[model samples]
Target: MNASRLLLGSFLFALASAASAATACAPTIDKPWVRSAPPGAKSLAGYLVLRNGCDAPVTVVDVESLDFGMPMIHRTVEEGGVSRMRPAGKLEVPPGGELRFEPGGLHLMLMRPLRPLADGDVARVRLVLADGRRVFAEFPVRRAAP
Candidate 1:
């Protein structure tokens, strides 16, 4: 009957729309920022919130920045009243989940700046994933908190 045919057509259209939306979904970087260091400082820290909107997990294998020589993921560890920072190697974000990089916790160690960065400067960085996907984001440089 025509009524059944109409219902089926609507269902198919809805399914197609959902599929298209899913394909359009991509990982996003939110609130990206970098800390301004002293004039002679060699290294600095970057922070951001990475969100995974796809259906599969994404692994951030490496990070690169045009302003810095080598950027790496690091975690702060505290034990016996002492705090230390260590490389995290790689980070994974589950589907529909997010990873937060903040001070006194997970952060990006940007080393050996090619040029000095000042407050209000924007730093461009790329997040390389294991699946050969690269996500680019611009981080605004902010003054270091006192």
Candidate 2:
């Protein structure tokens, strides 16, 4: 009976190790940054670099910001003598690849600012993955250079 119990314990340990190994290779984000809005500005933008270390693709479904009324993924498109902003449905990060949210490109649109964000202020944002996992990060507010 003791031998049988030992074998069961070993099997459970191996299973746990495998599960941990599989989860360790998931996509993650690093060094998120948000632009500081000017006084009386009602909206701002945020940027970040998402890294996919896994062998499978990951999709960013939604984003939540504690400092803004609404946070959504947005992309800037330039047409004939016109520039417009639109919602980005789902951001996909390819396997072993990366996605950059930068200025004049894909970025986070923070609307209806709850309070004016000053320089060097840190805003906490949460990104929800398609798999229902929530990744939290702190984005620092920086002045946009003219």
Candidate 3:
């Protein structure tokens, strides 16, 4: 009986260690940037490339930023020659795969700035995952893609 209990405890410890290791290699963001808007603009757009290196899939449930009052995942769609922004829910990145946030596609819709952000400024953003893990990045404000 004592040996069985010891084995179970060891298994639990290994499971916790594996969870920590997976988060340590969480998805990485590349080329994170916020499109530069005019001074006093009410809203802006942000873009990034997410590359998942974890052994399991990663699902981004929401976006948040201290620089903006409302940060969300949005996608641009066209209908009847008109373009519209729609909420994109739960973006998933497969293991060893990549997801992109580009213009006219999956992108960040940041609204109601806390302060005016200009070219060469930085916006701190956080991507909240479904498993309660958060990935953070500093997106530079730029007029063009880089």
Candidate 4:
């Protein structure tokens, strides 16, 4: 009787694992990282590359982080010889396309961390898409570039 119960549990676990794997989104996240900030800093920035392997467009509507008070998508634009940061409402990735968030360009503005995040720490973020798909990515915190 114990053996039979164990086998049943294993089968259920396998079935659930397969279902979760199948439901995961097709967009692959690479090079996810956040810039290290000083203690008591009000905000920090993160960057990453998102590659869409699906045949249809993927729209990333929101970003959320448990460690931070707010995670917002932003872009740095230069106008009139001045650079300013602006909120990026939504970013869309085309089929077989790639979106890059880099320095001096698009980035994730992580505001009001619950605790101080130093270098070598990992921050988990969730990406919410327009199609009701939620994907997670871990961003490693690194020292700022000199």
**Global lDDT of model 1:** 0.88
What's the TM-score of every candidate structure? 0.80, 0.83, 0.89, 0.81
Clashes of each: 0, 0, 0, 0
After superposing candidate 2, which stretches have Cα over 4 Å from the reference? none
Off by over 4 Å in 3: 1-12
Which lDDT tens digits does candidate 2 get at residues 72-142?
Answer: 99999988979899898988889989988889998999888888789988888888889887778888888
Q: What is the C-alpha lDDT of each candidate?
A: 0.88, 0.86, 0.94, 0.88
Q: In model 1, which range of ten residues has the least summed lDDT?
A: 18-27
lDDT of 2: 0.86
Q: Is candidate 2 or candidate 3 better by lDDT?
A: 3
Cα deviation of 96 in candidate 2 (Å)? 2.4
Best by TM-score: 3
How big is the positional error of residue 41 in model 2, measured in Å on the Cα after superposition?
2.4
Ranking by TM-score: 3, 2, 4, 1
Best by lDDT: 3
lDDT of 4 by residue, 52-91 (tens): 9877789999999988999899999998999999998888
RMSD of 3: 2.1
Candidate 1 residues lying further than 4 Å off, grouped into runs, are 1-24, 144-146
Clashes of 3: 0
The deviation in Å at residue 141 for candidate 4 is: 0.7
| Evaluation by lDDT, superior candidate among 2 and 4 | 4
